[model samples]
Target: MDALTALHNRVSTGKLTEPAPTEQQRKNIFLAALRAADHACLRPWRFLLVEGEGRERLGGIFLKAAEQAEGAALTEAQRQRTKAMPLRAPLIIVAITRLQEHPKVPHLEQHMSTAGAVQAMLTAAYAEGIGAYWRTGPLAGNPLVAEGLGLANNERIAGFIYCGTPDKAPRQAPDLAVDEFFSYWGAH
Candidate 1:
């Protein structure tokens, strides 16, 4: 698919299955992320690719972090569900913003750059026929989850991007009015 098509129609695929993106597809997606607009060229971003057994380990981390946050033991069903979260996709990319001290670019801009990078990757995945979803919730910012993932003090989780085959065909993109979202500056 063309870049414009992907940008306009890409939608998140939550029900991903096995057969993760091939190495070539991953290369393409990762390369696209590198092209994200960065202020001052700070490049204050990094990513952790988790797959295979590593995903199960990440599930363990999630289970621990969730329990820690809740301050109580999770029920058996909750424990199983929590540990299975990472198994939802065959590959998971943990986007991290490595804050940098810069006079021109603020930390928030750095985070925004990481977000743009994730969006780029999502677009690339759509172009390659790979299903993708960007997820972030309480576990994303959980201290134990960060520590388990080996993040540094200067690093913060931007999102967790899940990539794999779509369980079903791609759904049609919703048609929304652009006027509702777009506006001209100081226009009537």
Candidate 2:
């Protein structure tokens, strides 16, 4: 599909099924991510894929975060719920950003670059008939999650991209008027 059509049709696929993408397919996805718009070629993005039994380890990270956040107040049931998040999908891709020392490349720029990479990955998945969803829910920003992903103090987990075969065809997306959001010069 063309870029505009692919973008206009891309929708988050939260409900997925068994059989995650193969290693070769994942490589293709990563290649697409590398082509994302990054000013000065900083390449500040990194990704970690969790699949199969590896997903269990990721769930442990979420559980740990809940434990740390709630301390002794957290109930066992809540802990178990946290542990179930990664199991909801066939695969989870952790997006990370590393800070660079460029004088002109601020931290925000690096973050934008990472986000670009994430969108590129999602678009590539859409193009290849795979379902992908980027989530920055509570677990994604948990400090224990960063530790679990082995991120540096200066690095952070931007989000998790859950990917798998779609359980069903994508639903129609809602449309919004752009002019409602746009501002006119000297209108105020």
Each candidate: RMSD: 1.1, 2.2
Model 1 lDDT per residue over 1-188, tens place = 88789989999999999899999999999999999999998898899999999999999999999898878678989999999999999999999999999999999999999999999999999999999999999999998999999999999999999999999988989999999999988957
Maximum-TM-score candidate: 1
Model 1 residue 83 lDDT? 95
Q: Using alpha carbons, what is the TM-score of model 2? A: 0.91
| lDDT (Cα, tens digit) per residue for candidate 2, span 1-188 | 77788788888888887888877878878998999888889899999889998889888878888888878577778778888888878988999999888988899999999999999899888877788899897777788888888899889888999999998998776797889999789857
Overall local distance difference test of candidate 1: 0.95
Worst 10 residues of 1 by lDDT: 65-74
Clashing pairs in 1: none
Q: Whole-model Cα lDDT per candidate? A: 0.95, 0.86
lDDT of 1 at 156: 95
The positional error of residue 163 in candidate 2, measured at the CA in angstroms, is 0.4
Segments in model 2 whose C-alpha atoms lie over 4 Å from true places: 183-188
Cα displacement (angstroms), candidate 2, residue 158, comes to: 0.4
- Candidate 2 local Cα displacement, residue 52, angstroms: 1.0
